[model samples]
Target: MTTETEAISDDALADVAYLSRSRNRITILEALRSGPHPSGRLEERTQASRSTLERILTELEERGWAERSPDGYVTTPVGERVIGEFRPVVTAMGSIRTLGEAVAWLPDEELSIGLHHFDDATVRRTTPNSPMAEATYLLELMREASVFRTLTYIAPPLSLLQSMRDSVVEGRMTATNVLTDDLVGYLRERPEQTPYWREYVEAGARIYCYRGHIPCNVFVVDETVLIANNDPDSGHPCEFIETTDETVRSWGRELIETYRRNSERLTPETFTEESRMSAEHTS
Candidate 1:
């Protein structure tokens, strides 16, 4: 059996030292995340006793996680990088574990950058008895927002459409939506729903259809999104995340904008032609 000392390389061991799992040490490092701070301030911020603070600070300085300058103690570049990478994982993992396989709805790259946003967000799990819970919660989120944006794999149901129409008519909200190419085609084929979408267009909601890229089911209400997996045939419980984290919301908006920029405007005249063009290109 490899001893702990023999198993870890010198460089790896050094990193471990910097990120020592000691609660007090970790607290001190987190307290310095805002900027440099004097010893007194660090003690107060971390709520670590003077002796504990002193030891951790000394260790941090030795490990290059901190530096004592004329003004105060500051986190070093290496320390910043470690914290930046580490904290997000720890924070996001809480949500990811709850989300399970449903977390794959967001692109891997976007998820990495925005995971921290959902650190304090809530997750709602849906069962067969409450199949419409996700949509209901999404509508409530929309109702709470002054401005909303969304990327959807499925078309809005009549109930959601009516609610959105009421919100728009009352001047309560404005929205932009991006739908997958296939959904747009599906809507075009369904005559009953055509008027609903047309009414949305008349209410001043902007709509676009993305041809490529994987479909995402996300609803962004101001700084939060109702996010869930794109599974339509799964019998397992569906997981949804509702978050107001600025980073995640910003990324969600940017994601929609990227599709919007590359997508076709969903006007009645362009619907058929654009759908055909998208199908040909995708094929």
Candidate 2:
């Protein structure tokens, strides 16, 4: 059989474990640790009912940390000792003295942010303000590349249309368009506006029309980093990113791969039927 002292120690440890599970219980215990009060006073102070306070006090009494009296309750010798030990542990856990020191411990590489811009034949501006110009320059580079691949998320906007026309007219590069359903509809009805789209369909340019919001707009060329922006500035007016950074380039490539894996392809035959129906509707 366990001795009275050993049994009391086991019960004390169990009480601590039980109280630790509830922050409310911990708060009540911490409040009562200073001293004890009447059931009504403790209830008011802790915002618990009298019955709940009595139950908790009963538990504390069973653990030999508190005693009931004619007046109400009081901390026992064991209770004072337990609270004294707990104070230092709680103090150590709560201290935020080294918050700055903890922040300083992070690696230097992860804390760096900068920009590098490249033009067709040379390095352009390498400042923070160069993203817009850099995006336009990168688009021009894709227009000039011999074997360019494009996977646009939305319809070809006017700027993109002009770029495609220039690319075809200059015999620079051919492009594959992976468009959203809305963009496909826009293209189908504006047949006269996008002769390049018709020409591309005729000349074996792969087109895909899908339904859903294409969460991002991305453009990549010849596996070299070009433009990657998640939140481009107002002058840029597009929530897209353009970058030559290795990290950004990998993200762009993964996006393209994911789109290819998920999207359905629309062939010339599909385009012709859709275009004719759109033309008849408009006419």
Residue 204 Cα positional deviation in candidate 2, in Å, after optimal superposition? 3.2
Give the alpha carbon lDDT tens digit for every residue of 1-283 in model 1: 8997788799876665656566676667777766888999987877888898888888888878889878788899887777777676666777677656656666665554655556667777777798878777767766767887888777676677777777776778897988887887777766666666766777777889888764567778776777765667654323567777777777788877877898877764533545556755876
Candidate 1 wrongly placed segments (more than 4 Å): 1-10, 17-20, 33-38, 70-72, 109-114, 235-239, 268-283
Clashes of each: 0, 8
Badly placed stretches (over 4 Å) of model 2 are 1-139, 157-159, 165-174, 224-240, 269-283
lDDT for position 264 in model 2: 79
Estimate, for each residue in 1-283, the C-alpha lDDT of model 2 and write its tens digit.
9887766777667766776665555556566666666777777777877777778888888877778777777778887777666655554343223222222222233223211111111223334666566546655665766554545544544665666656765666666555677777666666554566765666655566656666545566655533322222333333233334464456556655666667777655544655668656876
**Per-candidate TM vs. native?**
0.78, 0.42
lDDT of 1 at 195: 66
